[model samples]
Target: MDNQHVDAWKDMIYPALISKKEELEMLGYEQATPEDVWKCLSVKVWKGEPEKRLHEMVQDIFHLKSSVYLSYLTIQSYENDDLAASVEALLGNTENKES
Candidate 1:
């Protein structure tokens, strides 16, 4: 995949994985790698058809509960300015409202 799509994947998935760190540790995966967390979160997000679910998630990031700044930070951590810009463009003009 291209960098833009890879960035979108990281932008959507990494935060969810990070948020599960404590949970994964509590479940005896104290040494969990990013790949491990990715697997775990992917399973939790969709028990079946993960690739399809992930595609849907990429489309849904705009509707995520996370603040725009937080999302930007997550994308920036991966050094994907293009994805960060895409995220900002999607969120910049919107009112802060939870769904």
Candidate 2:
């Protein structure tokens, strides 16, 4: 994939994975073990497709929306500058204002 698609993938996949990781941590996992976490997430992402499940797992869990979008970005990167910035800004604002 091209740099833009790679960035898009980073934007979407990181948040989702981080969200899921937080959820899992809240459930008392203590720490994020790649095998356990990835396995659980893979199951959720693939939705029981045996053949294409692995590929789908990575794509769904890490690709965000679809690889097709990445392919599009590969050709001519997306233009959503503010799409993922809000979350970071919110976190930053919260940290600065925290007690």
Candidate 3:
């Protein structure tokens, strides 16, 4: 793949992996290592425990509760295209708060 394609893949891959991790967690399976998650994604060699690293990386990239909620909202947004309003309703004026 070209550099642009590689970059796009890299960008898209992480969110999909994150979504998978969330789905697995919801199903009650704690990922053993980030590498395990990556191996499962078949995207790359995971460098560390998937659970811990994924959790840490997610938190680093997104605010604590917001990241989780954002991930959830993103899914819903795609599902119905009304997630923005849904998020506004769920969060109320808090949605306008500074991040």
lDDT of each: 0.49, 0.46, 0.45
Worst 10 residues of 3 by lDDT: 1-10
Question: TM-scores of the models, in the given order?
Answer: 0.31, 0.29, 0.29
TM-score order of candidates, top first: 1, 3, 2
**RMSD after Cα superposition, model 1:** 15.2
Write the residue-wise lDDT of candidate 3 on 1-95 in tens digits. 22232223434457755665576567555642333354433322223333334344444333323344345445645857676778767797676
| Model 3 CA deviation exceeding 4 Å by range | 1-8, 32-35, 43-99
List the candidate 1 regions with Cα displacement exceeding 4 Å: 1-7, 39-99
lDDT of 1 by residue, 1-99 (tens): 333333347656666556554544565557645454444334334355334445555444323333432343455457677878888877875645533
How big is the positional error of residue 34 in model 3, measured in Å on the Cα after superposition? 5.3
Ranking by lDDT: 1, 2, 3
List model 2 lDDT by residue over 1-99, tens digit each: 322322234333555567555655665545644343444443443445344333343455544332332343343323344645777898889999995
Best by TM-score: 1
Model 2 weakest lDDT span, ten residues long: 1-10
| Worst 10 contiguous positions by lDDT, candidate 1 | 61-70
Best by lDDT: 1
